[model samples]
Target: MGPRVARCAILASAALFLYSCTFFEASVVPPGFAIVYGVSDYYPASPPISGDSYDLTYPDDDAIDMAALLVEQGFDVILRTNEDATMTQLELDFAEIGSRIEANGGSDTRFVFYFAGHGYGDGMDSVYGSSFPDAWDSYFDSESGASEPTGSGAFTEQLLLHDAMPINSISVQSVDDVLAVLDESLSDDELSDLLGTLPSSMQMVVIDACHSGGFRGSGTAADTIPESYEGWDEGVSVLDTLDAITLYLDYGSGLLDVGASDVGERQAIVISASGEQEFLYEGPVYGNGIFTHYLLQTPAEADRNFDGLVTANEAYAYARDQIVRVENEFFFGEGKFVPRVSGGAVDFVLFEAR
Candidate 1:
């Protein structure tokens, strides 16, 4: 079946309040173009991080396999791995693809961007009680009207490249510090510029790394949280609690707000392997990032309705369920690896089996 459009209206509310009520249009089986990147190597090529066990074992594999899966689904795919997966190359590719799509008059192209590598951010979610003690004091205390800060630090998430390196030399730094250095290689403004090249309004961005959800942005669904909620813990200050909840939902919601994009009728979905304040893990048993391992299973198991098509949401759901279940079983229910998706109101088919 050729691509078809679908309309969706959703009114979603949290236990405390309605975060969003949106009406959006979705598409199915649209003509697809994708760029997939995976980095299993890092800076200091002499000894090689991969050789030192600091490099990932399966991200390169993830990129190759994901590209294969997209090709099978009939998407025009570009795969970048290891040395080729650099910010400069990505910029060139983005510009080239954007030109091609623009040449077509910005048709309803389904654009997909996937990255499997080191990502920046603290992945500190207070809503779920996860926190970075150092950053917590400096980051949130300022808003909470606390006295002179004990810690002076902040955190945000960003995609990393192959040549990423440390920004500072802290004998013992937090996990967030490591992710941050890699992220500093690519600024958010630069990323936005790169994305601006793509003329398509319909897009799907998938990130598999620590704090991947931060890419979803925080202005949309996150602004829906109410200013007043009586459920605050007695021991916590209101500002502290609200800040935690807001940041968590902002980075973890997996929703992107493209309302301001110049492209008319814009709708973009972002799927992340972990929450903004979370880290992803891979093991030899799976031979891929846990999130990717399950996502690769989409073609075979994600068609929940068995309609011969697997929509983006369907694929996300299937992967998410499998991740949670498997992690719970293996970690005895202590697993916190949860994938997230953020987008406008529409969900589109990403794969078709006929």
Candidate 2:
């Protein structure tokens, strides 16, 4: 939508399953380039809390599969899974893509960025003995709130990279800094000129993780979960939950600012796995984040009209419905997750049906 500068922290709990960002409307751009990443393991080699393993079962698989899918769609892809999906490597890959795009006559480049792994929104404090990276000390304060211990509730949501620790992960600001690096490399005039010729440049980002919706910013009252729900166990506070939880569909507050645009169209679409207050699961049934499992099925299972082509909206509706249905059947309507998509009228085509 627009640009957002502040954010609030989300209250999250360690879940038994996995935890785990959108596009153009109607018009399908030819396959261009993609950056795919997933992490099934992390640093420190242990869970910050008991029973909370840094190791996940399906994220790496998700990344590899998603990359393969993009490849089938005719996209040039840069894939990084597990240990290779580090922040350092991501930056390098992203920069390389930018350089390559600039060298290739500055044409419009469509980018598909897929990340499946962990997302942390519970602020940057380690309640346990785990030590987080010091770089995050400025943005998250566990005692105060958001940026300051006594400050207002304003903290950036993060997409936990492979090396991410309890209080250390990649934030909106971190992404923005990366974009800024690219922006600084080009003169403002040159960037403006490039935008004039490349109006179709856009990015589609899909994320599967817990509290992933925070990337979309705060939501309305409709996004709040009632305290009466039974899923709030495992040592989470009802009051804190009520205060921190929100659907967060404000695309302005998302990673759009960090897209390939930097100062161009800002046409970035985000698809997130769950609401800010909800937790999503990964089970042996799918061996993928529930949303991703269904998402990968879109070409076949989500083609509701049997059109032989899947649009962004179709994939979202398909995955969202399946997630609700599966979770309802398992939790008996007690625990369910709502998937979210945010961008500007982004109903573009994802792929041809199988």
Candidate 3:
């Protein structure tokens, strides 16, 4: 069956199950938690434009859709968009988030944050922006046709982290610039200490960007970076920066060793659209990026083993296989495009209430 049809079936089954349960006797599941942010346009000091303007649309849409799905599964979600908000507003929103977390009594809360927008990297850092201005310097001209910013730095993840919300999962549809900011945020030991301060829960981060190789333009979706960005290079990988941040925090404890399984105890999963040697592509149908499209369309039932849950590892495995199958069937039949997921095992439950 098509994805839409499969989704409908799942919804129907869920509704029936909930309806059949005794009203008062029914077990109450704690609500899932979420905070969503989407930035399409930028302000006066924005980054350079790339590809096409439409690239901004999909990530925001993905965030909304994800929020809707979470709501369907009984989550209490707060969504923010760039259209009617500003960066200062986002900061305030995050502060409120911290308050809410404290009020909710963090123990049972499972906070998730999602961002979809442009990302860039500096020589030693990566950044995520709401619009081209934040990601590229080329778009900073007075008459430049780029989106206006909401005053929030292109990267808002650190701000959120500073709010001390105790987030469990963070899914970012970052471009190269945003990744640079993430790297910078982690440059200090304070950020690492903040990460360490959180409860021992599963954490998941999903990034979609082009890093290397000739696979850059194979897809069909629009990009927000300018054609002039064809030669732009931030000089660092978001993953590597994250690793560095963690290493700095490890402080000779060897806790941040690469490929170490125990690291799963704290931060758990990272799903990247392409490998370190490949660049993620945007296709027409996929809208945002090929990897993200596959992730959203994946059927919950695909977790055939019925582990009562589908971890990030399982989701990535499924998405990788499917992305390859689709790519081969359509675009790059002669070439292979494989998405990747790093870190260790993470709990990513799908059929559970909330």
Q: For each candidate, what TM-score against the reference?
A: 0.67, 0.62, 0.52
Candidate 1 worst ten-residue window by lDDT: 145-154
Instruction: Give all candidates' CA lDDT scores.
Output: 0.63, 0.57, 0.42
Per-residue lDDT tens digits for candidate 1, residues 1-354, read: 223222212222242244332322232556788899999886553243223455778899999999999998888888999889887788778877777776654767778888998875432434335433344333434444221111111234566787776322321145465444544355433455566678776678788887665565433333121211122224556765665455445443533211221111134577878765566778888888889998898888888887788888898888878876666455422246577776455777777844
What's the residue-level lDDT of 331 in candidate 3? 48
Output the better candidate (1/3) by lDDT.
1
Residue-by-residue lDDT tens digits, candidate 2, 1-354: 122222211223222122420122254455467788888876644345444555788999888888888898877789998778876787677777666656653446566667788765444344322344434443345335333111011223456676554333332235344332222222212323333343236556677876565554222222233311333334545654544332133234543222121122234455778754456678888777778888888877777777677777688788878766666467644356677765344456677778
- Give the C-alpha lDDT of model 3: 0.42
**Collision count of model 3:** 42
- Cα error of candidate 2 at position 14, Å: 59
Task: For residues 1-44, write the lDDT of model 3, one tens digit per residue.
Answer: 69999999999999989987646363334435556655444332
> Any residue pairs clashing in model 1, and if so which?
123-277, 123-278, 124-277, 254-341, 254-342, 255-342, 255-343
